[model samples]
Target: MTGVVGALVEAWDELRIHRLRVLLALIGVAVAVAAITAVTAAVDMLSQAMREQNERDSGRSVTLQVNAWPATAEAASTDTEAIAAQYDLALERYGIEYSSRTLYSPVPVRFPDGTRGVDMQAVDPDLGVINRIVPVQGRWFVDQDVDAFAPMLVVNEAFMQSLGLSDLSTHPTVLIGDTDPVRATIIGVTAQRWTGEMPSAFWLYDQFERWWHVDPQMGQPAPTLAVWVPTDQADALSERLARDVQLAAPGWQVDVYDNRMNGMSGLDGATRWIGLGFGVFALLLGGLGLVNISLVTVRYRIREIGIRRSFGATSARIFFGVMLESVVATLVAGFVGVAIAVAGLKAVPFDRLFGSALQDTPPFPVSAALVGLGAALAV
Candidate 1:
């Protein structure tokens, strides 16, 4: 240990003496490490951002979507209601924790000035959880919101702007109904990112069914039940739920759909491939920079090596000492680079930078920093 320590001290002294050379090597390693680290972290952030965007559009990972229709095309108005009851029953039977019923209906809303058709969605409270709905303004519906005399509504930013309603402090009401307008309170406003400029609103599924007369004769969308389960159990649970629903409502064609396929296949693989290519390029740059420094270092340190050899330093010791100098110097440079990268990322607001793409991504991924340091050491 003492001999090793002595050799390390000697190697460090040589590095201190060759100030210009060490500076050049350190600069190269630092730049390379920072480049690799920043690229890795940025790619990871982008991937996560895209993930959040997709989840908002579709449901979250391992989400099971069930589309059920009564066998007879010309069904009584009672049939849709019965079908919903059976679906809800099946959900309870399976002990599903997070589930939502989405009933998409184009309802005309009457503003103070004029009325327009808006995409009104009726959903259970869990719909926001399954879809990861983070409101920029207020919040999603809660269980207590269901019991209110008037159906609680969450509107999009565009919807609020269209109505020319600025303040959300005082609860505002919108007239939404097929016949005489059933007044619904706008409790919250969502950021206009997921839903486009088109006006949109959300109401409690149960309240909408109770208050609004959704005449099946008018040709409206059948409610879709979105269920969230563990990723490993999604397929199995969905299949079982389909079987149960069929038994619950005989003559009902139950179709279980996996919404995650499109998101996972289309977005994840593409981002991974793009990131892998860039990561490799970064690794090469870092390694090549270190290799160049090491090559030049040996030529300059030949005199130092000869003197150490005269003092009984073995060939292996000399070789390892040279390597250690590079490792120590590069390691320090790697840390500096990582610090700079972190500072750079923090200086610029990533959330603002990504805007819509950014969601729930941690301020910085420590793993990416560690990986950067490791890659620098390898170089």
Candidate 2:
């Protein structure tokens, strides 16, 4: 340890002695590290944004959708609701993970201007967990919200503006239903990524069910369930869920919609490849820069190295000294570059820069900095 410390001290002194040369070499290394950080961070952010966008368009991969279609067109929606409720018990038993049932229906909501029919969706609060429905202003619902007297609502920017509201701090309330406008409290504002200027309101199912009347038009659209399961377990769980539903209701048609089957089910694999490829590219660049610097440094110190050898320095000590200098200098340059990159990212308005598809610009990807440092060290 003492020898190592001595070597580090020597490396620092040499760095100071050859400050201009070291600085010039460091510039290339610093730029390379910075580029590595930027590419890695950008790749991660873009990939996640794309995933959220995909989930918004299609449900999440391994999303198990249950369609309970009764034979009779005139069957009351209440009957369908009861059948759907049966899965809750079975799910708990199987320990089948994350699930949300969404009921989509046209609902009349009164804005200050006039009442308009909006795309009303009632889903559990955890829909954000199952699918990425990020909040722009407020928070998504919680299970405890069920006890609240007034219904909690999550509205899009367009819907909030349509009602002449800008600030989300005050818990805004809106009226639902044509004859008697039942008041509902606005709890959260969804980032406009998915809705994109469309007027929509998301509600917690039980709360919204109290006021919204379901007039059976060809029997209300079956509750589309979004179920999350491990990739390996997805097919089996879907089968079990469909079988269970069929056994529970003799005449009902249980259609399990596999979103992955549609296309691009290989997103996980693709993400891995993207990360690996970017990492290789970054290391390649950084390695070349560091190698050039190391070569120049060795050439410049050849006389000093020879003098040390003449003074009885072993080959091992010389090798260790050279290696230590390269590593310490590279690490220092890499850190400086990381600091520069992080500061530069601070100026970026991620939402505007990446477009609202990425609601909030994520804090600088820490993995990026780690990868940058790792590359600098390895080089």
Q: Pick the candidate with the highest TM-score.
A: 1
Superposition TM-score, candidate 1 onto the true structure: 0.90
Which prediction has the highest lDDT against the true structure? 1
Lowest lDDT sum, 10 consecutive residues, model 1, at 72-81
For model 2, residues 1-379, the per-residue Cα lDDT tens digits are: 9989998998788788878877877787787788778777776676666666777766666677887776654543336655666778667877866777788888888888888889888888768777777778888888999778887888888888898888677778888889877888988887665545779888888776776777555425566677877778888888888888777766767788776765453664576577668756765775676688778778987998899999999999999888887788889988987887787766666656556656444667888899888878877
lDDT of 1 by residue, 95-172 (tens): 889999988877888876788888888899998988888777788899998889987888988888887887688677
- Reference-based lDDT, residue 165, model 1: 82
Question: How big is the positional error of residue 122 in model 1, measured in Å on the Cα after superposition?
Answer: 0.7
- lDDT per model, in order? 0.79, 0.77
